[model samples]
Target: MFLKRITLLRENIPSMKKYPFYIPSIQNLEEIDINNKVTFFVGENGSGKSTLLEAIADKCGFNTAGGGRNNFYDVHAAESSLGNYIRLSWLPKVTNGFFLRAESFYHFASHIDTVGAAHAYGGRSLHEQSHGESFLSLFLNRFKGKAIYLLDEPEAALSPARQLTFLKIIHDLASEGDAQFIIATHSPILLGYPNADILSFDDGQISKIDYEMTDHYQITKYFLQQREKFLDELLNDE
Candidate 1:
């Protein structure tokens, strides 16, 4: 199962003119391949990474609730004008997958008992666990084989050490060919998966980039280089 291409067609989008509706246009759309076990989307805030993932999931008929066939009203509200293109495309469809939004897992966990139990080791809720432990548990226990998992900002709750743990889990998933992941994240560690395609969305377009060339990698390098100076400045300011 692979995603050959995804496209966006015209639809009514928000407008500030006389009418509140305007047609959204997507030209020279980005083409992403699921050839690799992991594909990452990296971009600044509001660059449409989440929108793209939702659109792809919508195109594939995955429930927005992150599980089996159960739709919510918000799913309708989340619909994109790009649905027209998704409707007309010939992408290999997906079934049995989870779209884990790191921020929303707290709410999501409340709904599933097994997930709740996993998060709550020995009757302790995920809240009782350190943020990193909770995140690792979610990644390790929830992701099974051969499913397309979509993750957004997974590193938000993880420390550098936990990020390494995530990398190991991802590597194991790939080796087993039981999972294909599309992750939108900022952690350099998560983006460091060998041979994974890194697509950068910037200035209204998406382009393939090398891992070493990523902003996350460069930013992390810069900080590590000037850690003492940064720490001094912060301490002095306080």
Candidate 2:
């Protein structure tokens, strides 16, 4: 694993009293250990999960939109200064890394096409394929492993079946023993990665949780087991 730990330095707390720093989970943040090959960040929107992921990726010098350092495309404004207050510990060697923010991936893909790098992703342009197809193709062809991958809600573009494929692909990457993943997602299937360190950001608190305890898993199980009951409850007018 490239990243060993992440610490939110206390000295930075005073500076978080304003706009960008208003994200509560980041305000109360502590440290997170990167002991496992796969670390999943799960949370509700506005819970600060994406913010933390963005901070980490930005701090580590990965492009804020997506792709490695050399793959530049200026689409987004500068990220929050939160990355400035965070500290990361790493192993001696971190060969390569990529930062992928799901919402911005389309822009990233457009940049790839603009740069005439279709060959990098298996001779097909990302825009030419279905979102899920392109997502899988990216890992299958471009993820040469021995690297760190930071992904934010990659499941946004994946079907359940495709999520499983992504899981398997990531599992295979982890099996190589040199790649590490820090992903923010709401997919139960992705969070089910065995032995992964799952951090939950619910109610503005970041805490470690088991797969079964995740809202994604719990709500999915409830909905599947009693679909009609849930439907009735959800559909019935008060």
Candidate 3:
């Protein structure tokens, strides 16, 4: 628990009508107290989960595009709009961390290759490996010791089994008390980590909710359990 809380600097904002700030959950956000080693941000698209995560990464001096403090490269429109308007309160600050943006991971891999830094990530080029394999390799090799990892939609490249594998990796890192993770994800499997804090960006606010209350969990459970009836209702025209 390096980062103890995230407080929105409402009084410093120049406009309420702007993007990011206008997003309902961010607009209403006062402060988010991070009490768990792993915190999961759960929300629908455009619900402001990723937005806040990106801001925190930016604030941490990690490239908002993706990568750690030293991994610098360019990608269009990669800056965080909300980063400047938020303050992160750290109990014992840590400078070592990584920010992973799923959509721009290819570019990050490219940056690694250009810098000849593949030795740190499993001693093989990320581009040479499958997407899921590269993700796992990065987790296994590079993640270590007193750091915060901010990941956005890591499930993009992972299969169900791979997600389970990722969860085990998370458990190993977190249980050691050496890493903190704040992940923005739509994966029920990832959200099911025992005793993790799940913050929902729904109903125009950010609030802690039980894992079972998430739409991801409820909907996935329903669809799997009642596929025929679920499809019947969906395909039916009222």
Candidate 4:
């Protein structure tokens, strides 16, 4: 229960909020509860899923770009101002955790090399491995239970098989180790994490929805079932 809930202070902004605020979904958001042990943020691009994850990471004392608090290599400060206005209720003590942004993982890996902490991640340089391999290595070697993890599109480099493996890692951490996860993703496979919270950020709002109701599931299901039919329509370029 280290990171319990989050609420937005819409009126507390001293000046105009920028990138995230400009996005319609985030603009109107007021509050979102993180009561569930595993919470997932699902939405289309620019729908505020990644933005919210970054803000949460910032508020939790992790790098807005990604990695744990100790890993700080702020290249350009590209994160938005949404973090300052976010209010989180937490338990007095939070177990150690990590914030992993797939996009900036390369930079974090470089920092690991600079600090000579490769042993903690996998006993080798992350750069030495392929993209997906590095990610799996990080989670497998690190990530003990009872910590809060924030991941933004972590499936970016993983294949379908790896996504399933990642999902198992998440489940093990939560069920076996008491770890909590907050993730933003587009993968239907990851979204099907056995009763995890699915918050949809579309149509200028964020609301909890059932697993089967998600567009990701429906569309993926439809496409898989009717790929040939869809190819007939999708490739019907007239």
Candidate 5:
């Protein structure tokens, strides 16, 4: 793996009662070892998975707003709050990589159009494509070489079928040993990648979890198998 581990610098923090530090998982974080080329970060909203991912992106010199080294642009409130408090350990560090934040992708697309770099993303403006198409276009065309990719909630725009397509893309990139991916996602499909490491940010801690053990897997499975019963329980007031 390119990024071997991430160490949280608790000593550098000015206060543990602050914004990022107050988040349970991050508050308790010590260190995380990245043991696979494809590592998935799974957690509930506000659980600090994305916060930590953004920090890694910041440390990697990528635009925390969402982009690779050369794609620089400004987005308000895009700065990573926790970035300064973590250290990444890379084995034979790589400079080539991309950080994709779904929320700020529109701004990245606008910047690409302004810079006339649409050719790299399928020869058409990303804005012209549907949201899912645009995401896939970037994944299919711009990802290559020995690089690390940090993606936050990539499944937001993808349909279930498209999500399967993304799995193939990830497999192709990772199998060749030229690319490593650290993705924060809620998609149970993406979490099923063979031999990938799944980290759960739950119960105020970060720990490894099995695929079937994930709530995403169990819930999705149960819902599919017992949709009526599941909805009855969920919708029942009593």
Candidate 6:
């Protein structure tokens, strides 16, 4: 399955407006050659990246709590009258995909345990594992080949090393043409996937960017470059 194009129409509802909610208006979205590959969505907090992902998953017919579902809206809908709107012009002509949200892993594990293979988790509940470990185990165990996956902020729970491991897993899936991944992440390591498209959502617009050109990479670079100066300033303060 391939995604051809994706477009957003509206976002960021204002308070005091008749309806104050941040809902996206998306259109003309399509995926191409996505049978086995990865697409990276990069942005800072509150930049509409996760919202777009959730919308896409919803259009793809994944259960709302599963990888493609968006429960964020449910919690915020009462507070914000604005609702999400999406248009998926094209998708993989196949089925069997997931929409995974990093923040909802605990809920996902619980749901999975009830109906799916409870013993596959080695008797260790998702709550028992460290966040990074749990993510790794889930990807390795649950992800089957020939599937499409949408991930929101997967880097949230992963350490840098674990992000690297996630990259390898993605590579393996893509190489086999068994999976396609659309991921929203802040980790430069995960963004380094070769040939993956990096779309940035900032200042109310989205555009393609190079891996090295991302704010995450540049900010991390600056901090590492001036670590000594930063440390000296801190140590000398008082």
Model 5 CA deviation exceeding 4 Å by range = none
* Candidates sorted on lDDT, descending: 3, 5, 4, 2, 6, 1
Clashing pairs in 5: none
Among all windows of ten consecutive residues in candidate 4, which has the lowest summed lDDT? 13-22
Reference-based lDDT, each prediction: 0.66, 0.85, 0.95, 0.86, 0.94, 0.66
Q: Any idea what lDDT model 4 has? A: 0.86
How big is the positional error of residue 19 in model 6, measured in Å on the Cα after superposition?
A: 7.5
Return whichever of 3 and 6 wins on TM-score: 3
Cα lDDT of model 4 by residue, 68-144, tens digit: 76776775764757888898888755747888888889888888889898998878899999999999999998789
lDDT of 2 by residue, 1-238 (tens): 6799889986856766774567778777788878888999998888888888888888778888788877877875646567888898988557488888888889889999999999999899999999888888888887866888899988888999999989988988999746899999988999999999999888777889999999999999999999999999999959
lDDT for model 1 = 0.66
Off by over 4 Å in 6: 7-36, 68-84, 120-124, 230-238
- Alpha-carbon RMSD of each model: 4.8, 1.5, 0.8, 1.5, 0.8, 5.0
RMSD of 2: 1.5
Q: Over the stretch 1-238, how does candidate 3's per-residue lDDT look in tens digits?
A: 7999999999999998999899999999999999999999999999999999999999999999999999989999999999999999998999999998999999999999999999999899999999999999888987888999999999999999999999999999998847999999999999999999999999999999999999999999999999999999999959
Residues 1-238 of candidate 1 have per-residue lDDT tens digits of 4454554432433332321112111233435545566899988876767667766666656555443334332332444444434442334555767676665566555545544454333444666667777677667776777677778788988888878888988888867856778899988898988889988876556778899998899978978999988678878985
TM-score of each model, in listed order: 0.76, 0.95, 0.98, 0.95, 0.98, 0.77
Report the Cα lDDT for residue 86, model 4.
91
**lDDT of each residue in 1-238, candidate 5, tens digit only:** 6999999999999999999999999999999999899999999999999999999999999999999998878999988899999999999899999999999899999999999999999999999999999999999998987999999999999999999999999999998847999999999989998999999999999999999999999999999999999999999949
Stretches off by above 4 angstroms in model 1 are 11-30, 63-92, 114-128, 228-238
lDDT of model number 6: 0.66
Candidate 4 off by > 4 Å: 15-17, 92-95
- Model 6 shows how many backbone clashes? 17
Clashes of each: 3, 0, 0, 0, 0, 17
Encode model 6's per-residue lDDT on 134-195: one tens digit a residue. 88877887677777788888888888888888888898887775687889888878888899
